[model samples]
Target: MRLFLLLFAAVFLPAMGSSKAVCHADVPCTLGDRSYHVRAPDDWDAATPMPVLLHFHGWGRQGDLIVNHGRIAGHTRNRGVLLLAPNGLGRSWDFWRAGSRDTDFALAVIEDAAKRYPIDRSRIYVSGYSYGSAMAWRFACEGGDGVAALLAISGTIPQDETCASHPRDIRHVHGLADPVLEYPFGPGGDPRGAVRLWRDTLGCGAGETAPDYAIRPFLTLSRTVWDSCAAGGRVTLDTHPGGHFIPHGWIGWQLDQLAGRAPRYP
Candidate 1:
């Protein structure tokens, strides 16, 4: 059984070099002692500015692991976006530590990608899972001015008193049965409280009583949205019946939202 699982991972996991080769070549950027990976769409040209996505991995994970197993590159393929995945200092990002270099590393990754690709400054976005999600929220709080949107999965926002004044689009996904990070508050923390925090910060009015609607085939999933917000902010929460995991369709849906396209799913 262990051998079979190994074979499965070997066959299914994407090769880091393969994705880099697809986009002409993968660009490796080093900041201090850490390095990050950057890949552009295969069909990209300098004719138009492309959107950028900065994805951070969960605890005990690195950029190569996400590039290989996270399915981020596969989802964004042909989507005309530059994808950047950065490694944390160790197994986790120092989200709560003041004077931490993680935030600076994130910003440096973005600036480096912009220098290499024609990135749409207004469409720069950040996303992550687990510990990385906390970093995403941290970025939204301290560096919201540079981020247009934030997508977090299986994690809660940090309890920070100071946050960016400008409103930005925010979306969170959490599972009620998440053994790692429970629904409202698991052993890690409460992701729903993070949602409420953003709602108040963005000045969002009362949201829908229930999910807007359910998506077919995913009975475990439901969504709540707060559209009436100040400073053009919008907040959304997606709940699921299972544990800490992100749906395969979420990346495409989020990309559509960033591109100003109507959601393809409920």
Candidate 2:
């Protein structure tokens, strides 16, 4: 089609033969009036297919800033995984219901990006914090085949919202003392039920908990995993003693776990 060529010429051409990413820190890839940020992995080869992680930023924040954070960038860089983050309209997301604007845009970004680069389609991942994490939940519900897994922190979907019966590899982290989104239950919905929705979709049995699962250096976590399900679906919930926040080395650790390089449980 005529339109397809125009897009390919615009998006795909520039990405070709460039060792660096099309978008990176302090720079953005503009799509219409909206923009997103990307950080390429260390020692990346242009001809090789690379895995990518799509991280949604929290309310009132831009994706540009997230790519600059050491917690996210430094960790993923070593794994050769590109960090792709989209800027939400008005610095926030409309994620309560499925088929929302942000979710649709996020999915389109995946399809669009795949054309521009040698993307490892089977390794696409989704993650978020606070309101962004809520978007992750909604995305899992509607993201279709574009999403491989989710790493959610401090958020959940709306209690009344319903999701497609699809299996996913989800690892959600929440602090029991979190006052902002709260724990187990949040202003949006009960995170336990959110985990349950995916668990049931996979037909996994009751969660097996490791009371003192320590992934990070100093912090001890309560890790629950459900692995006995169809299509190798896995749902893990990691809770800590602190409040609403990302435990040190937590995000990167999950990336390794999902890659089967690190342990998912003790």
Candidate 3:
């Protein structure tokens, strides 16, 4: 029994330690005064480049809060995509702050990730909820040089913002019953207008009518896709019957779209 226990400790303990080292739970990467949390899967290999998903939290929420409440880290981990959850200044993103360098901070985070890990530059994606969603749109529009795709949830671009960069694949997800950021239109801004801006910018033809599909018995989902666009750019709008929160299957479906495995939704 003693020898058996000795062998077990000699073999299994080291392996367990190695596994723990490979599967990082979440670690903070500090750049100047700002920082963000990064989590990678256990099977990550430094030699092979992997896709990265940088997620931003909504107003009054921090990076760790979204990681715990949003439950997107597990989805990204299952898909073998590195997850980056960046905390905005004072629990909110500075999207409209004139002197705030939030955009530069985001870029720095990506650059730091590339340096620290095997990040695929062509597959870098940005996603956010609520106020962070607005920042996501702003990021894609202004500094979308290396971003391959964007996922904006529960928010749209501000009316004053403009897309000065080239077109890219953008998917917007929102719930019709959201009281905070209402669907179709809201006191803050108009989602339809934002969708129209992308549609026109991407050079997509007139919108086509499509049937709404049921993701669940209670949650009916509809998708508006702009198929014909320049530079392979596509704009998609997904609406569901819910409130100011992301659906459970949204992250997985976004991963599928990125991997080219399945359509935008199940």
Candidate 4:
């Protein structure tokens, strides 16, 4: 019990001290028996109720390594919230197979984090890099209503009964030149088709056009929205022109939308 309190203090005290930290080593996380590397602003408070960003890294990247990359931490620091990067068992998220029970584990993390820090239940967001992106889509489709939003990067949603439920809060990001999940996948199953599935689920019109935005080196960001969703919510998509990588500023934009802040074009 004393060791647990000390661990809690190790986490709680730094935030109380107004310090920010991005951890790259195994540490006791909200999931008690499990420890994952996490990054966040030191000001995290359980009493202040802030938005939480649960970022799942791509295949082969450890949670601690993801934290070390500093992408998730850098995005949420200015907003004064928590950014958690939970390590997948074996460094891979098990979304397609049974007995994995990873979803329940993630849910536990959510409940645990809420108990440790001030979390706005209505503002919980999930994101992923690659394979993690696929898992994010799977979770959102299966149990998305509980979360405020989902941001999928560099991966496509898997074909499953989950998407049939028409999850309302989802934003897919993919590279136009991604060799892994090529664009415009149809009939036979393709990554682009997966996006179309979520797009259709969100009730977007087939004729809807994408927004115009400036192009980046090896990447171009495009946004589109579905109209008149049944849940009174909408779905958005951001397409880029690069390979398999988390597009810059995509996370920040989602956070802004979650925070009720209007988006600004770069």
Candidate 5:
């Protein structure tokens, strides 16, 4: 029994240590005075550049809650990728000010991630919930060319003239019943309005309409398609039935898209 126990400890302890080395949390990085939370896959390899997914939280939420509540870390565990959840100043993303430098901070986070991990520059994705969604669109409109895709959840686009940066590839997800950030939250327009702007900017069709499946209680869903981006990319607008939360199916479909699988509308 002693020999068996000793052998097990020798093998299991090293494995446990290695696991901690891989899925560890907070792994601090700086953007000005701010220190943000970032995580990566345990099996990350430098030779195989992996796609990156950055999640921004809404107002009144921190990075840790965003990471846990959104289940982003869990989704990426077996996917061989990096998931960055940066803490915004006071749990809010600043979109109203041009000189605030939130966009620069986002890019800085990406650059920081690249220094430690193999990041596929062409496949970097940015997403956010609620107010963070507005920031996501603002960042994309200002400097989305560096990323491969964009996902905005339960939020509206920034209502600023700076939206003038030629539209890039982006996908929007929102809840029609979102009281905090409704269909037309700001003068900048709602998720639908922002998507429409992109449809025109990208020269895509008006979009094919489809029904979305209910994945949760108090949820109805719908999706619209704006096809044929400038680079053969695609844009999607997904609406959910509930409040300011992402639907399980919507997130799953996004995961599928990231995995190079055909995304099914639900």
Candidate 6:
């Protein structure tokens, strides 16, 4: 009986929770060995609910690296939005296939964070870059009402799998001369088709690629939007003049758009 109990303790308990007593943004966090990271603003209110952006890091990158990144981390902190970065298992997500275990893991990370902090689930966002963006599509599609919006950079959904019925705001950024993921569609997935999938799923209307250019003329970005969607969901696809990359000012742009500060699509 003692041996059986010891064996169970050794195997099961570790899988249930981290050995560490506390989780913080400065270091990698965990729920029974599942690795991720978190960032709360300088003024975090445990009692007051706050918005959070669950960002998935790109391939070969860990959650810790992203949490320390300036563009995203800095913007979210100033807005008092919590930032959660989850490490892909083995530094690679299984986003190539739909209904993957990584989808559940992404949701689990959010749930685990809620226990320690007062999270505003209705304002929950999921974001990513490159391969991580692919995972973001998967996460948002499978997450349903649990996902409020999506912000992806340099990548698209990996397949044509049916997405969730719930409406969600989606904003994807890609470069016209993207060499890695290639323009429009490539090894990663179909950029145009992915946004169209969201458009159709959310019941959005006609899409128009706005001709206006914000930011520098050198990096003028083209914005395409499908509005009048179900549940107020809107899909925006921003294309830049560069290669595969997170366009400058992209982070701030997303935040602004969410806060109703950016220009209207219609």
C-alpha local distance difference test of each model = 0.70, 0.75, 0.71, 0.65, 0.66, 0.74
Q: Candidate 3: global Cα-lDDT?
A: 0.71
User: Which candidate has the highest lDDT of all?
Assistant: 2
* lDDT per residue as tens, model 6, 1-266: 65664555333422233445455555677767687888776454334677888888888999887777876786676676788999888898988766778988888888888766678888888888889888888788777577778888887764355776443678988887888886555235744564766776777777776785765446888788888886577889888768977766677668767877862221
**Which runs in model 6 stand beyond 4 Å of their true positions?**
1-20, 165-167, 185-194, 216-218, 230-232, 262-266
Higher-scoring candidate on lDDT, 1 or 5: 1
lDDT by residue (20-55, candidate 2, tens digit) is: 457555577776667787777655655678788888
Candidate 1 runs further than 4 Å off = 1-27, 97-99, 165-167, 185-192, 209-219, 262-266
What TM-score does model 3 achieve against the real structure?
0.81
Greater-TM-score candidate between 3 and 6: 6
Question: Residue-wise lDDT of candidate 1 within 1-266, one digit each (tens)?
Answer: 65664454334322322332212223345656777876655455434677887888899987766654435776555577777889887678987744556878898878766655567988888888988887877777767687888888887654435565432788888777889865655235644454876877877887764543433465456777888987568898888777887666676578887787875642
Reference-based TM-score of each model:
0.80, 0.84, 0.81, 0.79, 0.78, 0.83
**Quality of model 2 by C-alpha lDDT:** 0.75
* Model 1 Cα RMSD, 1 decimal: 7.8
Model 4: residues >4 Å from true position, as ranges?
A: 1-11, 14-26, 30-33, 42-46, 97-100, 164-167, 187-192, 215-218, 262-266
- By summed lDDT, the worst window of 10 consecutive residues in model 6 runs over 9-18
Per model, state how many residue pairs clash. 0, 0, 0, 6, 2, 0
Better of 2 and 5 by lDDT: 2
Q: 89-153 in candidate 5: lDDT tens per residue?
A: 88798877454478888888788666656678877888887888778777777767777778788
lDDT of 3 by residue, 121-173 (tens): 88888999899887887777777767888888988765444466533688888
10 residues in a row with least lDDT, candidate 1: 16-25
